[model samples]
Target chain A: MATILQFDFPYPGPWGEEGARALKDLAESIAAEPGLVWKVWTENEAEGIAGGIYCFADEPSALAYRDMHSARLASFGVTDIRAKVFDVNEGLSAITNFKIA
Target chain B: MATILQFDFPYPGPWGEEGARALKDLAESIAAEPGLVWKVWTENEAEGIAGGIYCFADEPSALAYRDMHSARLASFGVTDIRAKVFDVNEGLSAITNFKIA
Candidate 1:
């Protein structure tokens, strides 16, 4: 079953196009992570928060990536990172038009 | 551009297969909603919470669905729903292996 990984942290400024330019390299690296299927970059400028929603092949990969990413963010001076790893309800999700596999 | 809609509320679920059985009808109805690209049903049994992460074709559609779903959930005696609508960074997201098209 696929796993869902969500993480967010407080961020200041540089959203939209500029934000995309700045994060392009990091985004490319995330693409290469083991067991990663996809990721949707999320940002809230007014609230000053940023995050990504990710899908992984399994829980193990999600957990591994979560730990790695959390550490990476901390190294970048982000101290308030929040992360969650969830088991996807694949059967029910499929009925709602999301296909895993 | 796609919009991400995330909503979750407290629920004591009979998770796993039984949960699927219980939500099948609701899932089907959700699949038919306008502008819905996909929805991944999420739950945290240990925390007694349940919700979903959804992709809608646009922000208007997402907001509309959010209002409708919130009302429906309330009708089911579920309050305390937390919902968020986010704009997707499509260019950045694609680099992370997710294509919003």
Candidate 2:
């Protein structure tokens, strides 16, 4: 079963088109992360926040990514990062049409 | 272009095994909703919260589900429901290994 890791932090600029251009490299780097199945990059311009919902192969991978990503974000001057890891209810999720491959 | 809707509310009971049994019907009903691609049920027992991350075919579907689900949760005595709709950066997300089909 995959684990879900969600995180968000305050981000003030470069949303929409500019954001896509600015974060391309970062996105690629994240894709290469071990045990990362996929990541949905999320941002709320109105709320001034940016983050992602990630699916990892297991809890260890999810936690490892969270720690590494948190440090990376901290290095970039983000002070308030909110992150959580959840055990996915695969049976329920499948009933709601969720799929993992 | 799918939309992402995430919501969480204060819930104190029935996590883990109990949660799976309790939420099965709800999951099926959610799956039958229009334009719903899938849902990832999420819960954080330590935080005493429960919710889901859903992918809908469009913004309207996402918003509609949020409204309906919020009301349902409110009726169940959940007073504080936090919900957000996020526009996906699909191009960037692709680089991060995200796919929606």
Alpha-carbon runs more than 4 Å astray in model 2: none
Clashing pairs in 1: none
Q: Can you write out model 2's per-residue Cα lDDT over A1-101, one digit (the tens) per residue?
A: 58888887888868877899998889888889999999998888888888888999988999999999999999999989988888777778878878864
The 10-residue segment of model 1 chain B with minimum total lDDT is B92-101
Interface RMSD of 1: 1.5
Enumerate clash totals for all models, in the order shown. 0, 0
Clashes in model 2: which pairs?
A: none
Tell me the tens digit of each residue's lDDT in model 2 across B1-101: 68888887787968877888988888889989999988988877887877788989998989898999989998888988888888788778888778774
Estimate candidate 1's alpha-carbon lDDT, on a 0 to 1 scale: 0.86
Each prediction's Cα RMSD?
A: 1.7, 1.7
Over B3-101, each residue of candidate 1 has an lDDT whose tens digit, in order, gives: 888887898887878999999999999999999999999877777877888999988899899999999999999989988777888789878878653
**Worst 10 contiguous positions by lDDT, candidate 2 chain B:** B8-17
